[model samples]
Target: MTPVIELTEIERTFDADPPVRALKNVRLRVEKGEYLSIVGPSGSGKSTLLTTLGLLDRPDKGSYRLDGIETTELDDARRTALRGNRIGFVFQAFHLLAHRSAVDNVGLAELYQKGERRSRTQRAEAALQRVGLGHRTLFRPDRLSGGERQRVAIARALLGEPSLLLCDEPTGNLDKANTNAVLDLFDELRAQGVTLVVITHDEEVSMRADRRVRIDDGVLSDGSTSFQGSVLR
Candidate 1:
């Protein structure tokens, strides 16, 4: 099977008085339809890795291939197009437009992709229904619960029909109940053959993934331990 994401010796450094190396010789592979979690504490380069994977940031040195296409050398325009078409992002913060209805928020995702306005609206509604938020289509972000708001964000991400879903702290702001709901939704998505890569500090979230990788001090490790043993301080 072809890998959805492949990174080889990825390195990223932030220029400072003393340069900060955010990623050091990172190597990772995520196969199609795989659910992989990257666990790490704050400031551990996990976010940087996600940005690189999502094509929002370029590594200082490495080879990155997305769906069999080498992305490391692509021009900014090409990269942006690939990222927009192939990647979907879910952040901890809902990042929803407070004034827009759930359906509208989702429809915004399709605005850039060429399509009839009516078709985009229809697609948005379908995505919301998929996430169990069909009834909340008219609700604004402020009126929705934290989980509901996150679902809207997820719906927006899915509106693009992306090949890879990259979530950063997807459950960071939710209560246990909502977190479980989101995790369950992720399981369902996996069952439906969606590729998922989640970056989080939560142990419970990590355990739900089919594979887990630990990152600390800008280094990566194969996290093969039990949930109890995988906690990062």
Candidate 2:
């Protein structure tokens, strides 16, 4: 079966006073419904790789195929449309609007789809309910706890019903309890067949994924040898 995400010979560079290469001919493929993790130290091209996969940025040189469609050459409009339809993103800082209610935050993602305003709101509510946050839907960001806020973000991501979910340090701000809650949510999503790609530095988070890739100066390699600083599998 064709992979959900495929990258071939990927390279990303920054033209600083002294040019910098963030990624170096990295090639990767993520199968459908798989839970994958990318872990590395800062400046290892992990973020670069995520943005490229999310269609937020284009690689300097490489071919990216999303569900078999080549996306590297698409214009901004087409890329935006593709992202709206196929990808969902969750960031470390639960990027929720401070003034918006949890339901509204999630409903915002639904605005990208073609639908009546009421329908979108209903969908968002259902998404929040699915994430076990039905009671907190009316609360604003400040009114919710960290885990609740993260769940709101996840609800927003799920609102899109995309085939792929990209999470960048999802549990970065939470304590152990909240972190486990978020991981449990991921497990639930995985059980339901949602493909996940998480970028994290936490060993516990990385271990939860079926496959982990480590980034070294932009190159993608199996992280099996580097598992929690010791070889496993």
User: Any idea what lDDT model 1 has?
Assistant: 0.88
Please estimate how well model 2 matches the true structure, expressed as its whole-model Cα lDDT: 0.87
Give the distance in Å from residue 219's predicted Cα in candidate 2 to where it truly belongs. 1.1
Q: Which ten residues in a row have the lowest lDDT in candidate 2?
A: 224-233
What lDDT would each prediction earn against the true structure?
A: 0.88, 0.87
| Model 2 alpha-carbon miss at residue 149, Å | 0.3
What RMSD does each model have against the real structure?
4.0, 3.6
Regions more than 4 Å wrong, model 2: 224-233
TM-score of 2: 0.92
Report the lDDT tens digits of candidate 2 across residue range 115-220.
5676887898899998899998899999998999999999999887897999999999999999999999999999889999999978788889888888877667
Reference-based lDDT, residue 182, model 2: 92
lDDT of 1 by residue, 139-178 (tens): 9998999989999899889888899999999999999999
Off by over 4 Å in 1: 224-233
